[model samples]
Structure formats: C-alpha cells, structure tokens
Target: MQTPPDRRSFLKTTTAAAAGAALTSTIARSANAAGSDEIRFVLVGCGGRGTGAAAQIFNTKGNVKLVAVADAFAANAERALKSLSRGENESKVDVPPEQVFAGLDAYKAAIDVDADLVIIATPPGYKPQQFEYAVNKGRHIFMEKPVATDAAGVRRVLASVEESKKKELMVAIGLQRRHEPTYMETIARIHDGAIGDVISQQVYWNGGGIWYRNRTADQTEMAFQTNNWYHFNWVCGDQICEQHIHNLDVGCWVKGMYPVECNGMGGREQRMGGDASKSQIFDHTFCEYTFPDGTKMFSQGRHLAGGWNHVGEHVQGTKGTANPGGWIKGEKDWEFSGKKVNGHQQEQHDLIEALMRGEIYNEGEYGAHSTFTAILGREACYSGKVVKWDELLETGTELAPGIDDFTIDSEVPVSARPDENGLYPVPVPGKHNPFA
Candidate 1:
C-alpha cells in the first residue's frame, strides 16, 4: 500500500524548488486556454464544510467540477460525494467510488488526481502539512480556517504563503468574513478613519455547545479520537482556534495587525465530569489581547447554553464604534443597508475570479497570523501566563506529534483515559505549562 510522502521530503522539495513564479504563470495560461477554461477540483477532508466548499466552487462562474474526494474515513467520503451528487450543482459532482479515497494518506491520492485546484477542509492540525504538499505540487488551493492549530503549524503555513506567492498559486483561506460585502464595506470605512483612531475592540463566538462523537467499543483509541477530533486539543486546537478564530480574525483585521501579546483564562466547566476521552477540552475562554500601539481587544468564546450568544466583532475608536457586520454608532452612526451575499459562497466566487484573472490571491500569511493569534490566546489560557507573539511563534511545540504518520492502529497522541470517577483531566491554570 502506498503511504503519504514523508514530511522531510515534502519540506525539502518545497524549499528547494523555486519555480513558484513560473509554475503559477504556466497554470494560469493552462487554466485560461481558449475555449478550455474548465476548473477541476479535488476535495480533501470530506466533511460538511469540505463538501459545501466543493458545491460552492461549482456555483462560481466557471466550468468547475469535483473530480475527486478524500477523507480520513471511507464512510465520510461516500456521504460527502452523495451529498454533493444530490445538491443543486449535482452536474459538477463526478467522483466515482474509485476516485474517493479514505485513510490517513487519502489526501495524497486526491491531490494526485488531474485537477486544477484542491480544497483542504480538514481539521486545522492537518492543514499545514497538507497545504505544504499541495503547494509543492504547484496546485491552486482553497483551504478552510483557522489555517493551523499551533505556532509550529503557523510557521509552516507562513513559509508556504511566501512560496505560493513566488509560484503565484491562488490560495484562499476560509476566513469567509473577509469576502462578506457588509464586512468589507464597513472595514474599508474603518480603515478610512470612519471609526477614527481605534481605541478598543471586542470579538466573540460565545454560543451553544457542539455535538459529541460517541466512541464505539469496536474502534481503536486512535479511531475514537480522530472521530471525536473536536474534543482533542492536539487535533482541534481547542474551541478558541476551531470556532473563535472567525471573531479573532475580524479583531485583527480591524486593528490592521496581529496582537502583540495575550493573557486569558479558561476552564472546562459545563462539559465536564464525563468520560475522560469524551470531554477533555474547555468549553469557554476569555482573553485580553494587546496590540503594538497599546490597543486592547477583549475576546470571549464559550459553548455553554443560554448564557449569551454574541458572535461578531466590535471596534471602538476615538470618534465612533464600528461593527464589522456592517454598522457603526456614535459620531458616524450608520447601518449596512446593502444587499448581503452568503460570505461562505462569496469566498469561493472571489477565489475563482482571481484564478480567471491570473491574479494570485494568497491569504496564507494573513491566515497564519490570525491562526497564531488564536494560538496565543489558547496558550495564555492553558498556561495561565501572558504569551508574547514572538515567543509563541518560536516555540517548538508540535500539537499532535506524529500526525503525519497516522494509521488506523496508531496511538492517540493525547492519552485521556478516564479516572475512577470517569472524569478527564482538564487544563488547570498554573498547574502545568501548556506551551511546553
């Protein structure tokens, strides 16, 4: 059986090859060839988001089709294919059973197909590695965010961003809010001083809890954890990175820079006292981020039910306060009264448009920075210490070590065996070093 390419080779080849510029130009010409401008795509990580992205790509203005599908499980890939085949853009779904791949190495099989683009919607932990491989192969990509789950992964993504630019690959991150017309218009005005000198900001994703994947007795530890990845810190990067990144990205966007430092607190309160394997991650986090100019941004993310459900970004400036969702109050009181497009679908539309125009819209760098911002908040909450931007970026912490070599029988990187009371060990602030 064939295995995924080793990480060393992937990194070495990507670093050694300096043909990004030329390869990008070649891809542009090939994609835009007269009367043959068909954009073929392979969907990696056949989850709801992945399949949705495939369908959205077909919705774009082009002859786009889903040529292949890949997932960690065969069942998931089949479900995704079936879902796409029955969608409004069913004509674009062309992945035969043989073309649908499953297993840890399934992404390589999908990427190997003759396709113009690849959509990576896997768990954030797997993104950096998969993204590097796709870039090395000179493929245009549409990857979901948060782009990575850790500082180490962020480093790899940042490097890929530069390489993609050199090769001119059109890479778009799943920070879909960036494509929302309301947000775009509002932020444009904020940048134009409609919000005056930004003084403070607040971002949130506090909402109800997420679903839990019950572990089957027949499954291995690895299978169980991978199935319930969102609960695992190594795989999901915790709730802060997984879901709250959307709000955090908006905060950074409003400030026009990443945070300089972060300090926060979090704990697994509501979803606790369960089987160790089932409830390991926290359900709530509150972070205070400081930008370079001493600007402060208060961020809060929680999954507890019926407390408060605010999921937007608000920036307060010297003159006015602006909501990135298309509203402003105080000196420049205005509300977004324009038409709204589905930002989720708009992200794909913009990406395909850039491809057709031969323009490289690589969001890799910004994606990494935003992802790391979440990591900083997580590390702060986990370690009970203030984490500086530079130090966290330089940490050798590798969440989900040996993820590149995962197999059905592989051991789970985090061992969350239940205690006598069937409870898991949650992060205790000031008890252990999370960054270590």
Candidate 2:
C-alpha cells in the first residue's frame, strides 16, 4: 500500500545535497575529521557479480559502509559479508545478524533500513520493484548492468528514470563500458565524424563456457542460480537481452537513440539437456537493428564458448571504422589500436565522483533505453518477424511485474510462467503483455 519514492525527488537530490566537498574524491570517500557523512549500504544479491560490486565499494574511499545485507539464502549473504569483513571491508561493515535480511522480501528489508546507498544486485527478474522502492526512498543506487530482462520491466524503469531526473538522484546502472574513458573518447570521435559518414557495423559475443540449465534437486524453484537466469526467457529474456545487451547498449551509444526496428533469428540447437526447467531461451541469436535515421547495426551473440570467433565490434564508415573491444579501421588507412581498458572500474569510479560532486547523473533513462533496444532484438527473434520499436513498446507488456508481490501464480512475468511442457514462459509476440 505504500507508493514508492517520487522519481522527481530522486532526481532533485543529485545536484543538491550530494555535490559538496565530500564528493570531490569520487573513487574513495576521504575520511573526514568528524567521519560524519556515512554512506551505508544494503547488498541485495551475493553472487560473484554482486560480490565484485561490494569489493569495488571497499577499495573505494571508506565514506560508505556496508551496514546491512540480504539475499535469497542467508548463508550466501553472510558468506559474502564475512569475506568482505575478513578482507578489506572489516572496518566498513556493521551489519549484525538481525540486520541481515533474507528471503523473498530481503530486498525490502534492506532498503527500509537506515542507509544512504542501496545496491540492487539481484537477478534481472527482481530489478524493477526494488529499484522502484529505492527511488521512492531517495537512496543513491549502484545497480548492476542490464536494467531489466523485458519490455514490461523496462516501462516501469523508464518511468523511474523520469522521476530520478526530477529528484536529482544519482543512479548508476551496471553498464560500465560507457564510463570507460577510451570508449567515451572513441565514441566522441565517431560522433565527430572521424570515421566519415557512419554506416552499418558488426559486433560479437562468442566463446566457450558452461551451458545454462535448471538447478539441481536440492534447490527450490525459487532458489537463484547464475545459469538459471541465463536460460529462463521470462527471467533473462534470451541471451540477446541479458548478455548481448552490452553490445546492443553500445549500438545505442553509437546511434544515440533507441533502435527503430529489429529482425533476428535464433535456434536452441545445442544445450538440449532435459533439466531445462521451463526454459526455452536461445542458444544463439543474430539481430539487425536500424536507427530512426536509417543507420544500421548488426549483432551476433554465440554461446559456443572457446570458438575461433573472438569478441569485438566493427563500426563501418566511408572514412573507415572503429571496432570496440580494441579493433579499428580507417578510410585513408588511418589507424590506432587500444589496449584493453578496465571498464568496470571506470564506471564505478565515475559513480563515486558523481555522488561526491552531486552531479545530476541518472542511468535510469540511458539504461532503460538501451535495455529496450536489447529487448527489441529478443522480440524480433521470438516473433519470427521484423518488429518496430514504437509499436512493440506501445503494448505495455511488462516482463517483470511493476510490484514485488507474488502469490504462487500471481501473474508476474518478471520470473517465469510454465508452458505446456511445464517450461517457463516464452515470448508470445501477439499477446498484449505476455511476460506480465
């Protein structure tokens, strides 16, 4: 019955209360004489990725503290917290057993605590609702990449973005590539026409790794797993929306707008284990998305790990092109190669600086826009037809429910819905909001 934080209030604070001298050194909060401006945190997920973010915060200035922690499993959360405390995070974490909230509503318990920052590090399936609450509370957020798994989850995030802008809140999404200086500088060149008139481009995410599947018998259906979120179409919305979203986000960064349309094709020819619990996501997918002005971008995401195809992006232009992941081309043969840049740190550092500076930063918009671009690729792959962005988004078919309340079959698409074979939901294109 509680209305979430006002997005406008969230947006307004970014420029107001946050920009003082305390924010000057964004990487680490400089300890003050009084040590007063404490940025307490509540980590919602304890997976490797979530732990990585927690560690980053530790390496950063000790201005913020990990006060409380939560997860689906108490052991996992405590493990992560203990690891942090034993290592560099000992001085920062003050969470007692009682403060360590767990279970489905763990996210809520963490956010409701007295804290300055909220790290929404859970699965993509649970992002919208927690993010919504964090915004309402006017908390600074360090959210992971790929904001949502489907269009419906996205619509709510889009709304949240607008509210964040109005409130001046500093919202950092997980897409760390955008914060990297090399990538930012390179993109500026492309926009400056260094590559001449831009044309279509190609990008890839390929390699070898373990296959995604259902959890073992010991885990409940609600128990979380990395591979499970990867396979469940409703949860991960196919590889295109989940992993490949980074490339799609880059495509949006290059095009400077949400894609106009996408046509894609995919097949689950591999990874045919019977343990695929209600999961029918693709093993591989290739999509072509066009911008409003007719600029084209091609994306190829392959799951056949350890293959000859390495990962990168190629931007074609009359003057030549630049490939992300450190490849490049030129018209008169002008060329420059880059060493691998650490993007995660770049984005994290930027967020720290933004928070300290109290700059008006919000990932809600850019993240939502880029995520929807990724979903366009998924919708196209599922429907077997070319889909227009304006139309697909118009249906208001949210993948994750706007709210977190779920009662057995509570009509929430954020996670999954069983198919005839007892598999989770697949994208039903014709339906108004199949995921929800």
Candidate with best lDDT: 1
lDDT of 1 by residue, 86-157 (tens): 857788877787899999788998998888799999988789889999988888888999888777788888
* Clashing pairs for predicted structure model 1, backbone only: 20-167, 21-166, 21-167
Residue 54 of candidate 2: its Cα lDDT?
A: 81
Clashes of each: 3, 33
Give residue 240's error in model 2 in angstroms: 1.0
State every prediction's TM-score relative to the real structure.
0.90, 0.84
Q: Give, for candidate 1, the lowest lDDT window spanning 10 residues.
A: 13-22
How do the residues 185-204 of candidate 2 rate in per-residue lDDT, one tens digit apiece? 56657766777776787877
Q: How far out, in Å, is residue 206 in model 1? A: 0.9
Give each model's whole-structure lDDT: 0.79, 0.66
lDDT of 1 at 237: 85
lDDT of 2 at 110: 89
Q: Candidate 2 at 230: error in angstroms?
A: 2.0
- RMSD of each candidate? 6.7, 5.9
Stretches of model 1 off by over 4 angstroms after superposition: 1-29, 32-35, 272-275, 414-425
Cα displacement (Å) at residue 403, model 1: 1.7
